[model samples]
Target: MGRAGPAGAAQESSLRLACVWEEPPAMGTCFGLPCDVDSRDEDSSQTLFFHPSTYGSKIRLYESCQVAERIDSFHDGIIFTSRPIHLHERVTLKILKKEGPWHGGLRVGFTSMDPLEIDASLLPPFACPNLVLQGRTWAAVLPDVCGEEDTVLTFWVDHRGRVFFGRQQGVQDILLLKGVPVRAPLWAIVDVYGHTKAVQLLDPTRLCGDAGEPAPPLSPFQSDVLHAPACREFHGRPQGCTEPCVICFSHETSALLHPCGHASFCYCCAQKVFRRSGLCPLCRGQIQNISQARLGT
Candidate 1:
């Protein structure tokens, strides 16, 4: 048997994590059950999810077209910063929505372990001491997240182990959950686990210190993941034209099938591609026009 590559590993991991919350978990202890709002014990103070998904496990992103297209019930996301954070340092996790608080939104917070760290199919939510899981409006009781058009959330553990939460409004926190010790590394969790709300984690950065100096207001980055790929895929290049073009299966794509873009074929192969078919080869979007990808200008 051959070892898995990065892409292979990612796909396998996605498959395993894509279904952590299919059914509502039973109260008290749900080891491998769906840990939704129903799974949350009204008496418990900490977060709990027995059937936890793995870190960065997303449903639609990995499912087959049939399942993904019809996935209108709910969605969930759990990811961490590319790097680990330190105590007393402010870290911001921005939730950028493609649609919005359209249906059921996200249940956002931090967990000591990744959702996939456990082997429980009915994995319940785990809360570290005094953990805080904030949605759109408030926390505790109703765990609905589609309260407002919130796009940014900031979290930081103070020197005394208090975790603070806030939105794009500013450095000032909208909700504060105190007394939890910053025991281990914290990973951000978003439970969109049964709604059509498409959410993406953008630009997780350490804002500043929480000691003497007050942190500055959250601002937009000059560029974002949209403009550039966070990590290179192969040969010091973006995930583009790195493999065989799905259409011609011939030469590497010399021109980009722009607007509905993918370098699926060479310029010669694309001359009549759109005239015959108005769809993209990669994402299957309607092709507005095909443009040549420039290089070494």
Candidate 2:
């Protein structure tokens, strides 16, 4: 070539750099690896906040997009996450306000369609039976136990695409609905409908561990990944063996969580967990009752 343009010269220089070294000039990364690894790591640790633009007309965002409140009407309180959530990523929300005169509590679930793609004006006043009926959307009204003001709730989608709900201060998440269609990436959807008026997003890091404290409550997502297979072993106690509770490591395992049926705690430690988070330390299943582990079990 007689003369290389500036763009061509830049491309040639990049190729030369690539050939000269397996890694770019950066210290920690290779040529093919993303240079923004730190940014991605930061993002992975960031909590999910309310989407600023993709929400219902009646919904008002506040506190740097951490709080979402229904302004005029209860029905138009639909809102979504700032970005798509990963599978099994637990989303936590606190009820800031409630409308007692209204008939229902909050309705929450997931949708396969992107909220950003849908016009906010086109979103229905309610999430259930309206958007849910349209297909690819699923939502269930939270029971009154989960709707009290200041109550913190956590919801997540399992690998099966089933949606589960729970209270941070109460029992573990119960199955809200199952068979959520997995066509596209899912976005969390919440309708501050009925008795629910306003909700706030909670930072997940707070649940991971606290500063200068003992090990934080085992994260449901983390436990789900680590001990899923071992959790099944709790269905029955091994003969002639006394396995200590996972939490205390002092008491023999005794408590049995309901529905999901994972028994991983002693009766005493189980009570402590119930009083704290009401979740199974092993499977994160809702601890409905703590029964004595049967001799055969």
Using TM-score as the measure, the top candidate is 2
Considering every candidate listed, which one attains the maximal lDDT? 2
* Candidate 2 lDDT tens digits, 54-149: 677667665446667776644777888866666788888888777656555687888666654676668877676577666667677677777887
Model 1 lDDT at residue 297: 22
- Tens-digit per-residue lDDT, 1-297, candidate 1: 122233344433442233222211221222233433222232123211112113222333211010111123223232232222355544443333334323333444444443324332232332111123221111111123322333455556564645566666455664344443234444444443323234333333333444322233223441232233222221123643154333333445566655534554556556655665464432344667666653212
Q: Estimate the lDDT of model 1.
A: 0.35
Candidate 1 lDDT trough over 10 residues, lowest sum = 61-70
lDDT of 2: 0.62
Candidate 2 TM-score versus the reference: 0.55
Q: Which regions of candidate 2 are displaced past 4 Å?
A: 1-46, 207-297
